[model samples]
Target: MKRTWFTHPEPLDTTTANELIQRYTSRQIQTKKTLAFDPKFWLVSALLPEYRHEPKPSKQYQNSIWSQ
Candidate 1:
């Protein structure tokens, strides 16, 4: 089967683009388990903003070090 990739026109920094690509790649890998074909996964992702690229504190720890 033919495969196609789509990207938005909004300029993405290298980090943001890499994160988005990783998300898409993982989704594609998970699709292999599905019994039926679905395009909604990719569609929804495309519509959503790439917010995952931002650096955030780890949930496992607090910012005590930085608070000093």
Candidate 2:
């Protein structure tokens, strides 16, 4: 994984890249919000259910959760 992308570089695709970035950012925001709301165990809030199944964040943080 380390420096491997340099050997087999991924093709440039801004559309796909943008979508992936947005989804990743959205999940990160959700994870942060979940932990903030509970402040309990951390890994439980991130995984164990699946990355795509992260607990939904509050409305204030949800505006950016799913891509428009």
Could you say which candidate leads in lDDT? 1
Query: lDDT, candidate 2, residue 30?
Result: 27
Writing each residue's lDDT as its tens digit, candidate 2 over 1-68 gives 11111111233244544454456467662221112233332221112122444477668756565957
lDDT of 2: 0.35
**In model 1, what is the error at residue 31, expressed in angstroms?**
15
**Alpha-carbon TM-score of each model against the true structure:** 0.34, 0.27
Model 1 RMSD vs true structure:
13.1
Clashing residue pairs found in predicted model 2: none
Per-residue error for 18 in candidate 2, Å, reads 0.2
> For candidate 2, what is the TM-score?
0.27
Model 1 poorest ten-residue lDDT run: 30-39
Candidate 1 off by > 4 Å: 1-5, 29-68
